[model samples]
Target: MISLSKSIRWLFCLLLTLAAAFPAPAISAAAAEPLALGSSEFYYLAGHMEVLKDPSRSMDFKKALEAYGRGEFLPLPGTLNAGYGRNAYWIHFTLKRGVAFPEKSMLSLSPSYTNSVKVYVQRQGRSPLLPSSFSPVLLGSDVPVAERPVLNPNFVIPLDLQADEPVEVFVRVYSKGSISLTGQVATYGSLRNSTYYSIMIQFGYLGIAAVLCVMNLIFFFAIRDRLLLYLVLYVFTVLVNNLAVSGMSTLLFPNHAHLISDYMVYMGIGAQVLVFSEFSYHLFHDFAGLWLLRYIRFMSVVGVLTIISVSLGFYASVVPFALIGIIILITMLLLTSKKLLVSMPQSGIFITVAFGISMLGYFFQIFRLIGIIPLEPGWEINMVEPATLVHMVLISIALSERFRITERQLADASRLSEKRAVEIAEDMTGELRENKERLEVALAAEHLSAERQNQFLTMLSHEYRTPLAIIQGNLDILAINSENGGEEESQELQKMRRAVARLVDVMDVSLMQNRMLDLQVVGTSTIICADEFIRQQVDAVRWMWPERSFTLHSELVEESVFGEAPLLNTALFNILDNAQKYSPCDTAIEIRTWADGDFVMISVSNGIAGISIGDSESLFDKYRRGACSHDTSGAGVGLWLVRKIIEEHGGTVKMNSAAHGRISVGLAIPVERGETPYCQKK
Candidate 1:
């Protein structure tokens, strides 16, 4: 048993000796090849470097060097992108001078937000055994700008190299934000030129951003539009975030460079997302009541929380949230703006272009941060700055378009209102015209009815006149026959004759009135001297009232009036009859004729009893009578017929009531001037 155990121990010892003779395969890998500095302006060190993730963050410079010597560090195939974490990363690369390399060189590391960066350089020929051979430089946001070895916004380490000698560079970085590294080895002259170019570009971007901010700010004040204010704030946030990302904040605010680099960058990102979302909300006012608005509001809250978390020093935790919120917000805005295209074409197109550009920029940046797109040399400036500028311009145009659209909508509404009012007015006018036409038709029908009634009355009067004449003839014969009978019979027969005579007179008056009522055109008219006409009418009245006293006065200037002879004679007879009937049996009726200007005047004066002054004019109305005529036997249409007939002859008739119960009726007719006469239907 002792001999067997001895053999096993010898075998284990032999295996241990063989394992110690060769290093592990991991350590057997070849070291990174040294890059020779050439006449090129700058050299990218990412692909040429080795990386080691120090999760414990306890590894010092010596340990990093030891690990690199053992080839434990892995070669980085591309840019260093150790996403958001509290981890530390160690990067190592060897740089050698070429035939035309400059004596002075610099190692630049980006971005500036790294919490701590320590660089250790050891000349290859002398650095393996002695710690003193290594030169150390400190840089990062944690290190004050003034205290850094090289005064630069980003971490810059100056290198002293000997001719034909290679030097090893080791960088240890720890960050509380997204950990990304892009290193460049440049000569002094090249670095200066690159820095000047970067400064010029940055300043140009800043100038554009400032102009946009100020312009939108002015627009906000001028128009009192909150969308412009939100746009201004969004643009300002973009400027701040971009400055922080590019490390220009260090130069702008030297005292608070660390704060800007660490917290404000994330905060600015959150603020940009918040403000841009608000701008979108207001920009898409037509969609304010849509269900998508709720999602936008939710994203806005996320942006606000991101800002709050970053302010509370949870920058690394909130960075991804802020970036995600921006993506969601931009995507929502793009889709929403596209939807608006149909309703608001100009505004929608402009905003869509703006958001599309912004989205492209953010995608590039996010992809780079997440290591999806590797960072290359000479590609230091991301598309974000240019995209932001274009975005701001297009967004401004979109806002102006929205304003124009709003104004157009208001104008359209006003025009619509006016059109509606006009339509209503036209409707009312049309209704009034219809009513007026109806009223005209009714008036015409009433006038036709009056004419028909006048024609029927004329026929009835003619019929009654024939019968009354027959009765009068019969009464006359009876009176003659009864003259030989009893005195009572003779008296009765005389009464009957008087009654028949009164009926015949009434029939005559009725016939004349109806003729006047239906008179539209006279068949013929003749001129008559006013003096002769008045004298003839007065003689007829004196013959009718043989017992009554009558007088005629004439002061004519040979004036003749054109009229129908029978109508004029009837009008004069009615006036005379009225005067004789209304006056006392003992009073004398006076008739006068005179010529005045182009008219002939006929006047009849009579003594009236129980006639009020107010009732004088009403006597000319048909069926009108005076209080004193209640006991008299006469139709009341005599004066009305007189007035109608006189008016048809282009004349006027008026009654004047004088003191002492006296009334005078006057007729004025225009003298003939050898012109044709026309008449109108009543």
Candidate 2:
């Protein structure tokens, strides 16, 4: 049997060889013309390495190379900074000054290392290097790189270094290539024939890591669910897997290697357990389906046991950590089983099944690692891509729920706020503005009454004298006739009677108009339906104006219209009487009624000889009659009173004059289409 050191070395060499055989970029051929010994100055590649050389151009590099005398290590420029893979060593060199290196590959390992190890070389502090960046031109003879590599002792990597100019080198050894610790290869942890397999696994891990990162971000936006806490853990798990599989964890974070290797396996397993705990908590509600929690507790206990196993020595330490993770994926399945029990709805059942399968995949992964489950290309490594993907999916589901709920809440809040704002505006305008306007109107009305009183007294001084004079004349006649007693006395008495009657009628009309205009309503806490009350006025007017021709009409009123019937009556009579006096004799006066959903419309038409139609608008003003109203016998306050009545009833009046010289008055009042109008308050 071989010695221990020799066997271990063989195992290492075998692993490196297999790793080098893994899939990676093929090495490129040297340029058509070799670089000469003395050529260019310096070349660079960003943040990695840079080199300068002299007499660096050559065809056969073996002759021109001023290689180090054997038995000495080559020094290369390097850094210990965190960004440059902290605490790592590299080989940096320069040809004699004034030379440039071209088309040089500092180190090239067997393709197997594409998975188990990675080699990146570039001129430091410059942009990225491409294949065709520079080429060598020969100015010197051959070199000694053709000898079989001596570092091929299984564990040692045989590095091929060549360049037209002196170049720097960096080498990395992957700790994840867990080949057999013996010289001979085996099935489960083989040292040969699986080099390419390891590299592909690493590449797969990177792809998975990228996917996990993308999915986590998406979920974060969508669900914002507390479950994302578990997703974060899963993302870490993915990162750890990538580093371990790529061997980067060992090269860049050597302090974390062993821990990271085991962490990949354990965290991948532990994430499932945590996920199950969270799922069970969310799915079955309370602690109702708590057997899984107990299982998790048991697994955690085992994990601690596994950690202690480490102190027992490397041989016995692999069990607990691995076992805890694989104990039961069915816990997730069971968590879902309860959901599938029909009491649960199927809204998210697809997600449940998918996650359940993911849990199984985790179990399969862990089982495969410890030699329990068998699958093609078997063996768990520093990578957990599938597990990462599953975790990502779960995270996505949670985020979707969060986003959907948030969107709905925002929409609802927006609608409610908008509605409230509208209501507030209506209240301000309808209540406050209306009340302020009413107060201003009240003050205005008081001022108007004072002005009207002054005008009334002034007009009375002029008008009363004529009637009093006529009365005085009539009284004188009566006195004379009574004294004469016997001649033409009857005829004279009859004529006097006629004059007195005309005077009395005018006074009565004026008094009634005054009561309607200046009457003070103690309160309006009353309900007087226009339909009922208007009929009373219609009948009274038809009787009083027996000689006046007018056709009165009323239409269907779905609801009660509010108004003070008595005041309306006086107002209507004045309008009618005025119409009678000015209208051509024997012309029919028409009264018509109609109501829209919100307003009651009443139009009174008369064939009266009046002012021109152009002056109709002025008729509604107090003491302002249309020019067509000339020669009418009455105060112009008649139509003005119509406007006042309509205003008090929360309505408007419009006058329409026909081309034929007839005039019509139309009134519109705000009346409810249904329900009784609010009784007016006194």
Candidate 3:
């Protein structure tokens, strides 16, 4: 008996060890309560669903059944978000029909971009072990519309449920992109209505995109803006992507449904990234050295590589790249918009709002894609389309604003150019008028010279004074009108005033030359006090040049000269004027008058320090000016006339160079005796 007990204990210990090594398959927990299909039009199945991931992508119906019995399927509320991978998902749910439930209903899965979907339905009391007990339905983007269990954009399976009887449903989904799934059970009528609404919404978005594309193309042709061209291409890629994601491409090209579903969707993503990067680069080209541009260029390269990968049938590999590209895109948009807002407020407002909407939509989608926001049935109404629609509209408005601003700047420049042209024309007109007056005076002088010399001189003086008065009057009016003008205008007015002064000086020189041409004294001589005459001339010249200094030294003893008063006045005035013109402004002019034994002596002296001196006698010749006189305005006839008039009055004129580069001109006239009436003849 002891040996038998010891043997039993050893056997039991061996049995316990075997049981630890290989335990029995665990019985799955009771399935969640079946959902009751009532009078409601639609029911969300996510809350009542269970999900199991098949990473190997080789799980069949038999394996799925065995796994469900062992409770390998986990309860999934809301929806399934199996991120980017080549993974398959199995979803299980049970539904019971209430008294008011429809006999025939539809089981729908979204967002309709899934590559493959298979639905299996098993009626109550059906044998769980027999494959024939479960009816299978094939649907998805990869399945042709005609081959699908129902004619709908999304995957739909028809279900016929018995009253108060529970029906078991299982769905298998596989995708090369993000694997996000949500489902609903609805009456056939409800499913039809919902599907039609969804199609209408998607088509409406496409129509808006098409319209925007056409409008931007027209703008591009009209304005030749490259930014608009990039925008058009970007929008076109988005439209193509929408068509693929919305299942319209599969219906339109039924024979190539697999190609459209597999390649076109990812290709569209890459193409959009490429084109949008170009658009952004051009839009912010003004900021040439921005760091964001480098990143955008990198994204463009990634986009191209993604397209290449998709073309090479690396669909699964391209998905992660696409997600990374999207994240970069969102980052670029936000950062660029912020920069634009600070740089250009008017246009930036529209751009910021547009990018903000787009970013929000993309953020929501990406969060759902990465399982941050659980997928819900409401996700079927994609925010991207609506947000993109508003975004595109705002961006178009921004482009329009830029166009308007450019036009306004151009118009302002044109107006400024026209104003300048008018001012130049007015100046030319004034010059022509002055020249016409000068020509008339010359013609009149020629005609009168043949008749009488004095008559010609009279006409010359009158005609010259008339034009001078007119010019001075106009200049005064212009100066008053431009009192509040800019500095440039004020400077222009000063130039005109100087030109008028120069014209008056030329007239004076011409008249003096004509008077000296006769060389015959026509007026009677008069007794004039030398000191008084010199003082009067000095006072007159001081008024003309208020800024110059003049010093006078007189030691005359009641001495008088017999000569024409006008002729003597002209000679003294010419001497003083020459001194003022050649000397620097800050220097002083010295005039001396003294009585000598047989004549009254007069001298005018001024500093000509840096002037190049030639023969001083040649300065008395007509039209002979000093070397330093280039910057001063003169016809060089003043000293010649002075010499002639002094000689006619029985006086001698001599030029003398004094110390320190001072130049002096001396005039010695015979004093009058017994009041003899002298007719100074040349």
Sort by TM-score, top down from the best:
3, 1, 2
Q: Give the candidate number with the greatest TM-score.
A: 3
Better of 1 and 2 by TM-score: 1
lDDT of predicted model 2: 0.47
> How much does candidate 2 score in TM-score?
0.32
Identify the superior model by TM-score, candidate 2 or candidate 3.
3
Stretches > 4 Å off in candidate 3: 1-30, 123-125, 250-258, 421-682
Residue 586's lDDT in candidate 3: 86
TM-score of each: 0.56, 0.32, 0.58
Residues 1-682, model 2: lDDT tens digits: 2233453465457435534553222222321121132332221221132221212222122221223122122221221111101122222223221223223222222211121222233343322233222222111001111222212212222212233333333233222112111011122222223445655655566666667656665665665655555555546555654554444444444444444454553343444344444444454343233555454555545545544443453322445344434334343343435444354334255455555666555544444333333222223242235654664565466456545656788999999999999999998889988899999999899889867886785587458757767886877777688778865556556555544544443443344435446644442424556565555555555655678777878883544666555455556666666667767878888888776768777777887576555667877777887666556566678777777766777888787875466788777877754456543322
Clashing pairs in 1: none
Q: List the residue pairs that clash in candidate 3.
A: none
Residue 15, candidate 2: Cα error in Å is 36
Per-residue lDDT of candidate 3, residues 1-682 (tens digit): 1232343465457435544653432324545567899989999886677888898999999899889888888777557777677779998888899989888888888877887888889965797556677898887776767787666677778888899988888889887677878888999889889877877888889999999999999999999999999988988888888888887775567677765675667788788778877887888777434555676787788788877877686756765766656655654565556667777778889988988788777656655565556676666666667777887889899998988888998999999999999999999999999999999999899877755866666788888899889989998877766765642346556656756664565465446445567668376767876667677678767766879999998887567787776777778878888888878788999998888888999999998843445658888888888766777777887788889889998899999887777889899998877653332221
